[model samples]
Structure formats: structure tokens, C-alpha cells
Target: MDTLSLTLRQRKLLHILQSHENLITGSELASQLNATARTIRSDIAAINLELKPFNAKIDSIRSKGYFFTAENGDKIRELNRINTAFFTRDDRIRYLAFQLCLTDTPINVYDLEDEMFISHTTLENDIHTLKLLYMLKSPFINITNQHSMLSFEPDERKRRHILTSLIHRHWNYNSRENAIYENEYVSEEILDQMIDIVSQCLHKHRLRMEDTNIVWLNIACTIMYERLSSGYMLPQASPVSKPDASALAASNEILATMERLFSISIPPQEYDEIYLLISSAHILDPSKITLANTCRIFDASVLDMAAEYMELLQEFYHLDFSTDEDFYLTLLQYIRFILAPVHRFSTQENPSISKSHLITELELAWAFQSIALKHAGYYLNEEELLHLAYCISGALEFHFELHPEYKLSTVICCHEHMTVAWSIKRKLLGAYEKYLKVTALIPVNQAKNYDFSDTDLILLTVHKKISDETLGKIIEISPYISPNDIRKLEIYLQSQKVSFLYRNTGSVRSFFETAYWHEDYEFDNIFSAVETLGSEFVDKGIAGREYLSALLQRESLCSNAYCSGLLFQFAMTPAKQTQLSFTVLPRRMNWRNHKIRVIVTAAFTAADRTLVFKLKHFFYRLNKQCDITNAVYSKDELLQLLTAQPDAHI
Candidate 1:
């Protein structure tokens, strides 16, 4: 029987049906194979035709779906084993990619087509897909097909990196048992030995690693062993000076064990690469390790970069992070390994960290990326940015913990009984005790009479029509706070916190009223738009003559375009007064890569942090709620949108 006659999906369907002794529903089979019922029926029909000669068939009952009934079941199992199909396009591409990376000589296209049981066109398409994947995954490595001969870049380090990534990707999707059986490069025994060695070495050095990190290290070492045994060695490069003592010691022991077990001579360059990999893992506890030792591992320039990043963050967030030595050391260590010249480690995606919780940190990470590009000339990817966000998140927690005075002073007013007001206060204190300090509990009827001058916020538990003058400080909440109420409270607290930090006095509507909007405005480019709007602010005595130059300088460093608006701020120093100018272009114009119709240029004093925070939320709403491409918002409409309750928690 020709096992190649059945498609990959068909073979998988056959395997599923063969595993079941009784009847299996077509829907069950469809779900298992991720196919439709009709497709499963078609696949069953195709499989039966292939099995007709062997007297094996998948029969169907009237209503109970299908069952596998074969005259000789062993023949069908043999056929299924022989086919061993690559199920999806991704699977095929991964297989071909590994084949290309492992081979020293170029593989003929026709030879690959025959081996994979695919047509010439299919193989060509797979090659095209592989090129794109490699381009994104490892830009340094190039895949070429000259004269229908397929090969990749000859750099052993890149090849090994790609190989390790592919292995990890596969392991992520499949079970460990399946991964053990499917992995073709490293034997089970050798992988086990490598894992054992890595675990013991890390334990001996008091270096802690996550279980997944242990697997990753073992896989990397196993790949190194295989590559070395095949006579491929990493090219010698400048060694990392003053590598982490703990990681270096651990890498040395791991290498020694592998050398003895595999009977291969691993070079010093490989040890350096392993040291970098371990350092990049960031398993060293900052509390356990001293700053001096950690500082010794990084270059002076990297330490300077870390300091610059912290300063930039402080300036942007209006929060002081100078006293957090642990935060500084963590950022320094990450920057050191990330900026390494050789064997730069790619951060893996951490599924456990919630991106929503890291919104503030993510913003900080974005700013960090801008500065990193300006100074270091490297664009951080999403995963790398996420890693930075986690670090920043920890620092922010520590900062808030150390400085409880930063918390907002609050008074809870309720129209209900005294018990209800106390209940509300309990919930608020339970949830945000760190963020809020409840100053007083007042009844709704007596709320207007009491003095709230010292309180930063007034949380009313009942509906009360607040006067426009005090609306900025009042937020209505339910007696039993809902999640939505919590989110609104969070934003309010963040805005209020920034307001307190900057000593902001203006209302949200007043800030919006100060904005100058130009309808049907025309500009050839972003520079012209900035000049026209910035000069208007200068003419209004809201900004200095250096405002335009500062905007241009910031543009040169990083484009200010975000969402459907170009936000240009002259934050060199606090302005005497705040001014905002907005232009609604008749048509969308290209600003960097963003298609923006709204040009917003603002000159904000250092005390306008609340306005800056609100403006950010306003633009976010402007993008999500309004169709900037076609809809033209009037001044009142824009003001309304700006003052609307923000849905996202700051």
C-alpha cells in the first residue's frame, strides 16, 4: 500500500479512529483534527479508498458517527506509521527550516519535494515562507535558493540560535512526551543528562532558575553538544569582560560535564556564549547579590545608559526612582546583557505576566525604547519591551511602598445608613489601602456643608449633582463598588496623584478650553505643522522661542506621532502658562508611518502633569471612539470627548 496516498490530516484522522475501540462521532474526530465534519467525512472516504486493498476500512453507523473496522488492523497501523506526516504548513516549514539549518550542503529542491511528498510548487511556497520566517526571526541569517538548491547562512552561531528557537517553539506547542519522541537532533538520554548536569550546577552555585529556564538551558547545551560533535564551532569573538561570577561558574561546570559526557572539546568561546545565556536569563536575585558585584559585570557605558533611562523615566512619569538601588541594578543587568556585542539573547514571551496590569510599565518601556534607540541604536522588540515593563513594574511597586505619602487622601460620602458608609470605606481600604487614605466619612446631606478643602478626593456613594467648581474632585461610586467603578476610581486616583505632584489647579474642561483648534488646516508635512502651531503658542506668550527648536530636536530623536494625532510637547522646562493648539487637517497626512489628521501641539509647564495624563487618555479615546479619517469633530465635541469618563484604568 502507498502510505503517501493519504494526506497528513487523513492520516491523523485514521490514527484517532484507530485509538478508539468503540464508535467515535464525526464531530469528535473533527474536533480532534481541527477540521469540519464534512472534511472529516471526506478524509474518511479517502482513507477507506487507500485501505480498500488491505481490507481495512473506517465504517460508519446510521446515527452513531464512525468506527474503525478493519480485516487486518495491523496493516493500517503500519501504513499510518510509514506516512509520519507533517500536519500543518507551519509544521512543514519548521521541518524544512531545521533540515536547511542542519545540512552542510545545499539541498536540491526536487529532492526535498520527493522526500516530503509535496509538489514543486508547494515546496517553492514553503521555501518562500521559510525566507520570511528567517527574516523576522534571525535577520542576520539569509536563506537562498540558487539553481533550485536550498541553503542558509553559514554562521554557526546564528544557525544554532535558530535551531534552539525552533526546538523551543516546538516544545511550547507539544507535550513533553511528544517532544521527546519527535525531536530528531538530540537523543533522549543525552537531553536528560544535560538537564541533570545543568540543574546540579545551578544548585551548586546557589543560582536559582525557573523550571522552564532549566529546560531552555538544557536544550541550548544539547544543541551545542550536537553541533560540536558535527564539527561546527562558534567563531571566536571578543569575550565578555567580568562576566557574572555565579553564571560563569555555573556555565563552566555545565560545559565540563557536557565535555566529559559527549567526549567533545568545547571551546572557550562557547563558554562565553553560555555565560551570556545564563546572565540573560536574569535568575540572580538582586537582594542576594550585591550591587558592586553586579556593577562589575556591566561596562561603565551600560551603567550610564541605565542611569539615563531612569532619569528619562523620572522626568516623564514625574516620579522619583533614584533611591531604588535594587531597581537600578536590575535595569543595569538587563541593559548589560541585552547590549552585548556577541550572542545577543532574545527574550522569550512570558505568558504569565498580564499585559493589562503593566500598562504604566509598558508606557515606561516604550519611552525606554525611544531612548535606547537614540543612544544605543537598537530597536527593542515586543518581548524585550515586556521584560523591561516587568522590571519597571517591580520598581513602581517598591516606590509606592517606600513612599506611602504619595497615596491620595480621600473622604467617603454616602447617602445610605452609617453601616453602608463604613462598608464602602472598608472595601476601598481593602482594595486600595496603599493608594487611598480615607480622611472622613460624611453623609450625603451633610457632604456639601463639610469642609473638603484638605481632602484630595471625595468619593460619593450616591447620586449627587456636584457643582461645576468642585466636579474635578468628586467621583460618584456605588455603595457596592463594581469593577467598572473600581476602574474609574483608579483613573481618577492616578490623575489626582499626578495633579498633586505637579500642584495642578485647572479643571479638565478648562484645560480643553485653552486649546486652539484650526479646522480645514493644510500643511505639507509634520515639520510645517509643528512650526505653524508652535509659533502660535509662542505668540500667545505660552512658550519660549526655543519651543520650535525643542520640538524639532525631540522629533529628530523620536517621532511624536501617536494614534491619529501628532503630540508635540516642549517640556524642556516648566512654561509660565499652559497652551494647546490643535489642527484638523482636511485630509490625513503622513507623519512618519502614522496617518494623522489631528495635529496637537502643547506647551505644558511641569505643573501640568495632570493635563498631560488627561491628554494621553483623550487621544486614546479619540483613536478608539472617533473615526479621525472621515469624522471632523467640532471644538465642543472634542471638549466633550476629552472630559468624558475614561474607560481605561491609568
Candidate 2:
């Protein structure tokens, strides 16, 4: 029996039918598939005709719509198998690119047409279209011998990148239920093993890494290792010196594991190369980077670039990287990839510009490119600039994540229907899961009955007549959320000036301890000053040794130093008791590559923990002013600055 053919549309119809066992009306099917009722009737007739040899039939009910009935389930299964024969044009093009990338020799166009089940004219058209793409212009794709033959011109590094991107795209598409294709150059088992090795190494080194980044690193390593095993090695532009003892050890461990898995011996220089790759990918111990160690791995130019980038960021946005050791190290590592001789090519188009809050992101990207040109003597392409914007977005998310206690409380009010309110609430939760907490959902009629005292904003689905005070707090929004609405809300949320999440009812002055105060102290480094402050707190019996440990741990993640020579430090969790310490060092001391002279350390009990973040925000505002940081010298001067916010209502 001949297997029945199906177009993609008919296959989609079959999928929708299989999902719903009950009867559906012709109009409902057409609505679901975005077609007319007449078209749906014709498709049903075609479906039933194909099912005639099988056990299945598309049964039509007069009013209730349509349903599929299977007289013999085995025959229905055969029908499905035949529908799987249909392949997309995109699938064929990707397969052709994959084959071209993997093959060492040139491919005949006619042979490809036969393999892909396409006519010679269609194949030629596909090739012509592909050649016009920006990705194929590079050292990767090449057309030779009068455009009749095609070959992948490999620069080992570029090929590895292209191969990894293709593998990831394929895996992401089919990972849910489909089996890995056998024709892939690198098998699933090998990729999985490589991921395992990288995972193990990261765990052993106590490095903090995100899972997405780990997967990317794994793919990159696997492709690079595969290329090297196949005797394709990109020439090293610069010979690598022996790596840092720690990085070398980690790299050697990875090499040993890879050798066992692939049964291939790697050269010694590759050890350092792998270490460089790992570090460049931002998979490293955050605390391990210090002034002494940073110089060893990075050149003077890289450090200068990192500092310049931070300065530019501060100028563009009020972003403070003076004490962000992790960000500095990340930028340092990232610059290597940017400055490397190997040019990166992307087959995919930049689609991030279409996302919500794109205006703000693009503004940031433009600032980034402008700064890069000014400071680093380099300019980023649209794709690269978008990537930088992503990095900035990630950093912003991390900033809020680091302070999860500070969520913007929101209340949704909808008088139309409960479903409308529920739908809006669901969207709010999904969209702002990290930065917002939807406190309550109430109908507009019953809004007065609920407590909205704690809520930051009252979101209304429609215009409402309310008191002037209530109107000030209310923001009218669409019942169906739009991207522009989200952008406006995000901007409004950031601009909101509110009290701390964990504020104490007592005044800020009440949290201070007299014994913890010091004036005109002299210290050349941050470590000695921290130790001295810890001793004072311990002797006063206000905080334990754990408090100092937490403070040091926070510093290790990033410097607590901000611009204009002020340092604000706090722990993630509150201290054993509430004690506020003030230390004033008049001498400019080098701290985390920044000059710092004044330090404020607040140790708050969990009960008064809200004060920590409020104080941090207070310092952030203070850091923006040169007058406060540069002019304040005496305890009274600093006290006046801190207490000036009497209306803060702490």
C-alpha cells in the first residue's frame, strides 16, 4: 500500500485533533488553525480519504464539530508514520549546511539535490540565498570551481564555533521528545560526557557557574576537541606560557578526563589553552581574582580596558563598579575574546531588538558602543552590541536578585470579571517574577475593603473614579498586557521612592552603638581595617566572628567601595545583634584597585535587616554627590548627612 502524503498544515491539523479526543465543531477547528470553515471541511475530507486504508476516520457530527475515530489503532499508527515523511525547507537547508561543514571535500550540487529530495533548480536557489547571508561570507563557507561545487572552508576556530552553534540549535529543537540524529558529526553521548567533565571540574574548583553558560562551554569544548582529534588545529597566534598553578591543575584534570573519553593524547600547550578558554567563558572562582593574580593572566592593556569600561558605565548610567570585583574580572576575561584575532560569525539574525524594554536596552547598547570606541579603540557590530546589552541586562537582574528581599509590591484591581483579574495576575507573575510580588488581586468595588497600605502601586484595568490620594497611587493599564505597557511599568517601578523592605520602627540613630564608632583612623589596606572593626564589635559583644566572615565574603565577591572614596559593606543575612559601626580613614588607601578613605559597616539583626539595604541605597545616593564624599570629614558632618533624611520616616 502507498503511504499517504501530507502537507505541514494537514500535519498540524492531525496534531490538534490527537490532542483533543472529544468532538470539535468545524468553526472551532478553523479558529484554532487560523483558517476558514470551508477550508477546514476540505482538509477533513482529505484527512478521511487518506485514513480510508487505515483504521482511522474523521467523523463529522452535525453540530458538535469533528472528531477522529480509530477502528484499528495499528493502522492509525501507520498513517502517522507516513505523515512524518514531510520535511521543511528550512530543515533541508540546515541539513545541507551541516553536511557542507562536516565534509572535508567539495560536494556536488546534484548529489545534494538527490539526498535532500529537492529539484536541481530549488537546490541552486537555496545555495544562492545562503551565499547572500552574512554568516557564509567569513572564513567558514566557500563556493569553488565556478559556483558548481560547494565546500566549507575551515579556520579551525571558526569551524568549531559554527559547529557548536549548529549542534546547540538542533539539540534545543529536538531535546524534548525526539531522538538525536545519527548523522551528527559529534554524537550525543560524546557531548554528554564532555558536559559531565566540565561540570565535575567546575564543582571541584568551587566556581559559581550558570547552567546555560556551562552547556555553552561544554558544546564549545566538545567541538574544539572533536576538531583537534580530526587533525584540524588552528595555529596559535601567540605561544601560551605555563598557566597559573591553580588554572594549570584544573586544565590538566580536564585534559586527563578528555584523553580517557576520546582515547587521544593532547599536547602540553593545549592545557593552558583549555584553561584560557575556561576563564574566558567566565567560569572561574569569583574570589580567586586579586590584584596580584589579575596581572598574571591579563595584560596591562586588558586591565586598562576594564577600568575604562567601568568609568564609561558610571558616566552613562549611575552604575557603580568601583567595588564590583566580579564584574571587573568578567570584563577582563570578556575583553580577551573581543580582542582575539579570530573573527566571530553568527548565522542567526539579531532578534533581541524586538523584545519588551528594547528601547532602554538599545539606548544602553548605543552607549556601550560609543564608550568602546572612545576608551577601547574598538567598535562592536549590531550583534556584538546586542550581546553586550544582554550582559548589562544580566548584571541588572543579578543586582536585584542579590537583594531579593526588596521586591516591588503590586496590587491588581479589575472590576470587569474575575477571569480578567486572574489573567492579568498570571501575566504579572510570569513577567516580573524576579523583581515584583503581586500582593493582592481585588475587584475595584471591593478595593476599599482590602488593605493596600503595604502595596507600592495599585494597578487598574480601567479608569476609575477615586479620591485624589488613591488616584495618585493608581496606574491605569490594559487588561491585555502589551510590551510598551511593561516598559513603562518597569521604568515607573525603578523610579519609585519607598521605604526599605525591612525597616525598623525605631529611628536610624537608635541602631548605632557608641563603642563601635571610630574617628580619624589610619589604615593602608582594607583587610587590616576590617580586622580592627571586627575586634571592636566582638569586644562590645554586639556581633560574633561570623559577622566579620560574612563581611569578608561579601567583599570577596566584589569591592564595597563606591566613587568619591566611600565604602559601604553589609552581609547577606543580618548579624547576631543590631550594631552600627563607623570608621573614618582620612588617608586614601588602595582598596580593590580603588582609593577609599571612609568606611561604614552596618551589622543589623534579622529583625532590623531592612536597615541594611536602606543604608546601601542611602550610600548609593550619597556616592553620586562629590560634595558629600569629599566634604564630609567629622562624625558630626557624617551624622548630619545621614540624619538629613528625617522625612525618610524609618
Candidate 3:
């Protein structure tokens, strides 16, 4: 399958047909697809004529435009994979990005950097961090990586899955149904190296922080310290001022020293806040940071660091400070931990590159490194600061995640049976339940004569060892391009485009929520409840009908998640998610595989979480249920006769 095979007009026409499938208006197709009606008619005629040999038919309703029957997976794959060209290095990256999204693992920036040899600057501006948009659907797939592990959100996975499915038809479709392991642990050496890099950067670099932000954080911590410590037990009297002619001289001497240190004219108001923080710590008797106090003030991740900072502070200042130093100390700690290791994005890997540009930004952040150092010499060690800047820039470049979207079709070139295809599809759906809105899975043999355009094909699995020859086939056929995925190449093309899931776990989330009540991105997993519920309507084994599930899912194409957020999910299949009853997660006796915190109406056989993304009917139903979710949650309690066995009818 290569892009060279299809004419531009033919590809455009095909896309039009896909969008308006079964009811595309002829006029609309010509207008949207930018072709004259006569030209479109000819294309349609050609398509219809092509269908004849496969014993298939094309339909044009009285008011509708056109629709094609996909007699089998081969027909659909053959119909889409032909004549596509890879054309762009960006396309390769897009492919890699898609694979990252599909994978249930943490991706490494250094690894990607080394593999692609692209500077950190390029990554930050382009494909570095995952977008915060898609959080609900694919939730991060748990997988092991070379360094630093964390969960990716659902929206990222789904989007990548869709995009991956668009190009390489038959990939890992069965992953969603099988056990998805979420443990992505890096080796001790790599993790240590990353930590060491960040530590060095933070110690020497003059970080950027606004005076107001520092003031606020200082105030917040002081207030908390007062409330938590017994220092507030006694009332304090106001201090009386002594009128002394010598005080003026003393003040002049102090001002000179202060100006030399901070490079700012002394202000009484600024000193008041700093004095208050010092005084608060001084008053706490036999002070030691307590874990209970930290829990109330910071998140789990922050609290852990807060305790350590409390110890560091006590050792540095020789004064007691709370383990939870209000929000400032802990906030600073967590922010540092999260952001510290992340160096700023750098344009070169040559290590020896002069940080002239970086120095400029640093100067803006820490003005003292100039005037203070000029007068006091060694104010903050220039060489140390430069090295810190380099690392910070590098870390910033590495911070990244994935954005997930759907694929119109994936050309699977493997010679495997349908089972492998189905398994990969399930895993991909669950993994990408967030971003990928639409996806198509196609086997390999049927792809040689196919065409994939305007399709989100998630390349989930490679049945065989993929070679350059195999990838070339996809390169010539795919339409869209993403720059992050193709950082490297190998025997097989197995990767995903990952969208960053930006979610604030605690206070930050509240602030963000206040700013924007709802985000613009749609999460496929948010509809998981519905998809899971609708799976019941697709029983092919008991019903003894092949393609029943496919037919049911297709009918739901016009829409999913009707109106409400409350969705129930169930798969109507005798060959339900797998017979294996072990949880991939290493938890014992976990409730419903541990991720489901709410009720989603799961059937016994619907073990796969991907059903969350696959079912649309439940989505529509959930919309209707949103209003009385509280009632529905309390339904079991509202009944007058709790013990009575009643009829199934409401």
C-alpha cells in the first residue's frame, strides 16, 4: 500500500464517502471534497464499479449521497491502504508518538533525544509534554521504561490508538482485553543519574521566582506554622519604639549591607514578612516537623518532600520548622521535585555549547547574579550557575506527554488470524479510551490494495518482525504526520502518539477548575461507563451470529455518550474479555480491577476496561441519567420494602 497508487481526487472522494457514509449527499460531497459534481460522479461510478468484483454494493439514497458495504476486514483494509506515501520525517515521528500513546509505559526523553539527536529545545516546543486535555479515556497504560515512571492519562492513549490504527491496519488489538501491566520501573542507575542531574542544577542555578509569589508563600507558611505550633498560646504585646538619634546611623549601616547582598533598596515592608517567618519558627518549642501536619497541608508527593525539607531547614537555620511549612515550603519542595529534574530545553547536545541565550533568561530570573556578584564577587559562583542553567534547560526539554486521537483505519500486514487482531483492538481501545475518538483495525493481507486517508489507525501490534520493506509500505500510504513518533526506527513499527494529561491532583486542580469549569478536549474513557453498558447488546456467541458485534458498534457510529456523564458499560458476547481471572495489577482481592471507583453496571464477562471506549449506547443513556445520579446512587436505599422480591418491571 502506497500513496502513489491513489490520485488526489480519488483520495478526497474516499474521505468524503467515509465522513458521510451511507447518507452522503452528492452535492455535499462535491462541495466539501472540492470537486465538480461531474468529477465526483465519475469517482463514485468508479468506486461502485470496483465494488462489483468483490460482490459488494454501493448505495445512494434518494436524499443521501453514498455508502459502501465492507463485506469483510480484507475488503476494508484493501479499500484503504493503497497508494499512500510517508513523505515526511514528521510522519515517522507521528508514528512513534502514536506508539508511545498506545504503550502502557513511561517514555524517556534522553532515550528519545539520543535516538533522534534532536535538541531538547525542539522537543519542548513540539512533542515533549503530554497535553492536559485528554484525561478520562485511556488513562496511562502501565509499562516499564528506562527511567522515571508515571501514569499517562486516558485521553492520550485513545487519541494515539486512533491515529495508530489509521496507518498500519493490523497491530496489537488484543492488548486491551488481555492483562495490561502498569508497572513501568526504570533501573536504579538511570534513576539515580536523573536525580543527580537535577540536584546539581537546583543547587547552583538561580531559579526564576516572582517576589510576590515568594511573599505570598512565605506568609502562608508563617500563618500555618503559628496555627500548628503552641507558640500562639500566649498573647503578645505591641513593642514600643525608642526615639534615638543613633538609630538613624545604625539604620544607614544596615541598609548599606542589605543593598549589597540583595541588590535592592531596603524596604521596611519586605523585612516585616521575612521577620514574621523567622519569628514564627523561633517560637515553636522543641519543634519538629510532624507527618500528620504535613498530610493536612500537602499532597502525598509533596508531603514526602516537605518532611525532608523540614529536616534540612532545621539543620540549616538550627531552628524548628513544621514538616508541612504551610503551602510555601511544601509547594516549593514538590514543585522543585517535579520540575527540578527537568532541565530547561537546550538547543544542543554538544555539552560545550556556550549558554549565552540561557544566561540571558537566567539573568532575568535572578537579577542579583549581576550587580550583587559584581560588588561582592562570589555572590553565587558564575560557573556553578551556568551548569545549573544547562541542566534545568535540559530537564524542561524532557518534560512531555501524549495527546490521543482516533484513526480512521490501520493496515495490518500480519498473516495472523482474527483472534490476534481482536485482542490488540481491545487493549488499544482501553489504553486509548481518552483521546482517540475513532479507529479502524485491518489485517495485513487485505492491505496491499487498500488506501488509508483521513483515518486514525492505531498501530497496536506487529504480528511479525517488521522490516524496512514493511514500514515502507505504510510510509507511502499514511496521510497525516506527527513529529515525535519517528525518533527511531527498528524491525517493527510499534508506537503511539501520547497526549499529555494535565491534571492537578489537589489544590491546583481546584484553581484550574475555577478558571475553566470544563476543558475543550473530549475523553473517550469518560464514555467508558456507557461503552461498558452497551457491550451487552453485542452478544455474538450466544446469538450465534458473526459480525453481530461489529454491526452493533457501527450502528452506534453516529454518536456515543448521548448527553449525560453517567454511563453503564457491558459487552454482549459469550467470548467476553478473556477467561483468565488474574488482575494484571499486583493487587490482592482488589475491587473490580481496582480502577473503577463508581458503579458502571459491569457484566461478569466484561473484564476488559477498553469496553469503556467501545460502547456508545451507554453514553447516550448516561446523558439521561446525569440529572438523578444521586437518586440512582441511593436507589437501593429509597425502596419501602427492601427485602421484598419484586418483578423485573419498574
Candidate 4:
């Protein structure tokens, strides 16, 4: 019997029927195979047809489901033994990536097709997908196809890093023991030995690393060891020099222990690679080291970079981190690790801080990433940015603790009576005493006489518009203070408190006017849209000629594509004046993975920093309140959407 005649999934279906004594339902088979019941039914029908020639069939009893009945049990057993598990497209891609990483010679496309039990077209499509998604994006490796043969030219150290990442992607980081047993590249014994060696070396060096970090290091070491054992040695030219003495010592000890246990002579380049890994590991015992000592451990360039980042962060967040030595050291250490010779993939997941809680910090982090790319030729990934945001969030908490005077000074004005004003103030104070300090209570007629200089917000019960000077601070609310009023007040208070950048700046609507709105604007990509908008700004005397270049540079660093088909592009330098150009696309176009329909090009001078900050908060509110995906089409419609009442549920 030709066992290979059946498809992988069909063979698996036959095997399942053979293994079961009692009948199994289609739903049960589908659940086990991660397929729909309909798919299972179709597979069973095809399998029965294939089994007819061998006197074997999957017979179904009414309501009892399927059972295997074979005249020749030996032949059916042979078929079951020969069956291989079905590999999904993603599984095939990973397998192909590993094959490319491990193989030295060019791989023949036909050979791969035969080995994976796929057709030539399937193999080609898989390779194409791999190249487009992974290989083309990789900085350390390149794929070349010549005469139907595929060759991967990769840096040896980077190849090991990529291999470890591939393995890490599949294995559960939470279950260290399970990861060892489940890993396919290295044996469980080898992984165990590697972990023991790393743990012991870290202990010997008094370096208390996180469990996840330890697992990451162990996986990386095991990959290096496996590769070295297979006769693939790191080139001597790739060794990074001037490693920290403690990290180098730990690296040497770990490598020496591995050599003795495995009887393999490790090279110096391998030691340097391990040293790099150790230096990058997040040490939990940093509290033991003083800030001065930590400063001495890193290069002056790294320290300067860290200081530059802090300065930029302070400018954006309006919080001085210079006095916070702990924060400085933490940021310094993180910068040092990320800017190391080899990029270390962080095992940490997205931050535990809620998106709403850390909006300011995340914004600061995003801006930090943009500048980091310009200064240092490296782009921080989303995970790295979120991790940095978490760090910033802690610093913010500390900053707020030290400075309690940053609370918003609020006032209440009621049209009904002075008693009504007091009642509104009482309700607001009851809900947000920590964030708001109710300074005054005035009737609607007496509101104009009140001095609003020290006030951050003015909650009015009447529909009367305030003076143009204090228009931005006014929030119309009901005399009874409804839930919608509370929601609006909460948003305003949170935005004002978190974003210290808000300094009595004019309203976001002030910067955006009907004149700046471009209806039915069309562009090919994000870059083109930014360039065209920037050019318009220059033509209108809102920005300088160099503003276009600045806008392009900022956009090049990282995409500013937000949710709901919106793209926010900014200039690197300040413009002549503050202006926001809103371009509503007639049709949504692709900006990387996002479909961008609205393009907001901001041209702000140094004086408009506070206004820009407030604009960001407004956008955040707009995203939460409006259905930007479907409703926004025209400029008037968008303006109306922005001017609409705040959602009561929010």
C-alpha cells in the first residue's frame, strides 16, 4: 500500500478513526484538528473514498458518528504509521526560514517542494511570502535566487540571533521547563546544561537577572552551541571590543563551563557574543550600584545619548528627570543595552500599564523613538517603546508625588443661581477633589467680572459663550451636573494633569480653521501626502522652505498612523507659525498597514508647543468619541464631528 498517496490532513483523519474503538462525532474530530465540522465531514468523505481500494473505510452509524472498518487491518496500520502531521502555511514559513538559516549551500526549489510534500507553485508562493515578510525586512540577512536555487547570505552572529528568535517565538516564555522540552533545535539535555551554566555564571557574578532574561540567554547560548557544534563558527572580525569587566568575566566563565561540559573548543568571537548578551541582560540588582558607578560602567557616548533623550523627554513632558538619579540610571542602562553592537530581542511583552493610564508617557515615548532614530541609526520597536513608556510612567508618578501643586484650579458658573453654582462645585469636588481645586462659584451674570487668570478651567451651567481669551477653558455643563458633564470634566482634568505641556494654550480648534481644510485630497503614500501638505504650508507662508524636509525626516523615522484611518505628520523643527492642515481623503489609501483617510499635517513653532500638546489630547478625545472610519467624509462634517457633544457614555 502506498501510504504517501493520501494528503497530510486526510492521513491524519484516517489515523484518528483507526485509533478510536468507539465512534467519534464530526464535531469531536473537527475540535481536535482545529477545523470546522464541515471540513471534517469533507475530509472523512475523501478519506473513505481513498480507503475503498484497500478494503478499508470510515463507516458512519446513524447518530453515532464515524468508525473505521478494515478488511486488511495490517495495510491500514501501515497507512496510519506513515502519516505525517499537517503543517500550516505559517509552520512552513518558519521551517523554510530555519532551513535557509542553517543551510550553507543553495537550496534547490524542486528539492524543497518534494521534501515538504507541496507543489512547485506552493513552494514558490511560500518562498515569495517569506522574502516579502521576513527576509526583505531583515537588516542582517539577504535572500537571493539564482536559476531556481535559493541562497541566504547572513551574518553568523545575526543568524544565531534570528534562529533563537524563531525558536522563542514558538516556545512559551512563561513556562521555562516546558520551553526546554518543547524546543526542536536543541535537545532537552543540552538546554538544561545551558540553563545551569548561565544561572551559575550569573550567580557567581552577583547578577540577579529576570527569569525571562535567563531563559532568553539560555536559548541564545544553546543556539550558539548547536551552530558551533555543526562546524559553523563566528568570524573573528565580528567580536565587539571594550566590554564591561564584570559582564566579560561572567561571559568567560559561562563559555568555559560550556566547553568543559560539551568537550567543544569555543572561539574568542563566541565569548564576545556571549559578553554582549550578558551586558544587554536586565540585571535586577541595579539598586546595589550607585548612579555614579552605573555612569562609569557605560561609555561617554552612551551617557550623552541618555542625557539627550532625557532632555528631549523633559521638553515634551515638562517634567525634570535630572534630579531623579534612579530614573537617569534606568534610562541610561536601557539606552546602553539597546544601542549595543548586537540587537537583543526583549522577552518582555506589552506593558501592564493601561493605554488610557499612560497616554502621556506613551506619547513621550513615541516622540523619544522618533528622535532616537534621527540621533542613533536605530529604530525602537513597539515593544521597546512600550517598555520605555512604562519606565516613564513610574517617573511621572514620582514627579507628581513630589509636586502636588500641579493640580488644576477650576471654577463653576451657574445661570440658575449662586446656590446652583455651589451645588455644581460640590458635585465636582466630590468626584475629582484630587485633580480639581474649586476656587470660585459665580452666577452667569457675574462670570465676566471674575478674574480667570489663575483658573485652568471654567465649568458653566449656561449655554453662553465666554470671552475669546478664556474660550478654551470653558466647559458647558448642566446645572445638576449630569454623568456626561462628569465624563467631560474627567477627560479635561486628566488631559490637563498628565500633559504638563498644557500652558493656557489656545484651543485645538483655533489652530484648525476652514481655510486649512483640504477636501477630497489625494496622495499615493504617507510620504507623498506629507510632502504635498508641507509644500502647501510653505506656499501659504505658514512654514519655511525647509519645513518640507523636516516633515519628511520626521515621517521617515516612524509612521504616525493612528487608528480610524488617521495619519498625523509633524515637522522636525518649528515652523513660522502654528497651523494644522487637515486633508480628508476622498478614498482611504494605504499607509503601511493602516488605511489612512484623514491626514493632519501639523506645522508648529517653538511657541506653539503647548498648543500642539493640547491638539494631541483633542485627537485622543476625537478618536474615542467619533466614528472616524465611516462618518467623516467632508471638511464641514469633520468640523461638525469635532464640535459635537461629548459622548454621555464616555
1-650 in candidate 1: lDDT tens per residue? 35637665676677667767788888557545545577888898888888888888889887677888888776666566421356667667878878888988999999888888889998887887787567655545888889989898798987887787766652422223122114667776887788778878988998876555566677889899888888889998887764478888899899988888778899989998888777667454656656657556567778788878878777766667888888887888778656755333333322212333453455467667656777679767555666787898788778777778878889888988989989999988998887789989888888768776677778887777655445557778888887557867875654444333334444455655667888767787667877777788777787788777767655544344443443434434357687777776767786754567667777777666345555554454355446665565455555555556432222
Predicted structure with the largest TM-score when compared to the true one: 4
Superior by lDDT: candidate 3 or candidate 4: 4
Per-candidate Cα lDDT values, in order, are 0.68, 0.60, 0.33, 0.70
Displacement of residue 47 (Cα, Å) in model 3 is 46
Report the poorest 10 consecutive residues by lDDT, candidate 3: 174-183
Ranking by TM-score: 4, 1, 2, 3
- Candidate 1 global CA lDDT score: 0.68
Q: Tens digits of per-residue lDDT for model 4 on 403-520?
A: 7687778888777867777777787778666667888887778877788888888888878976755666888899887756766777776577765566556446545554487886
Consecutive 10-residue window with the lowest summed lDDT within model 2: 172-181
TM-score of 4: 0.67
lDDT of 2 by residue, 550-631 (tens): 6665453333553445676665344667776787666566664345656777677756654554555455545433355457
| Models sorted by lDDT, best on top | 4, 1, 2, 3
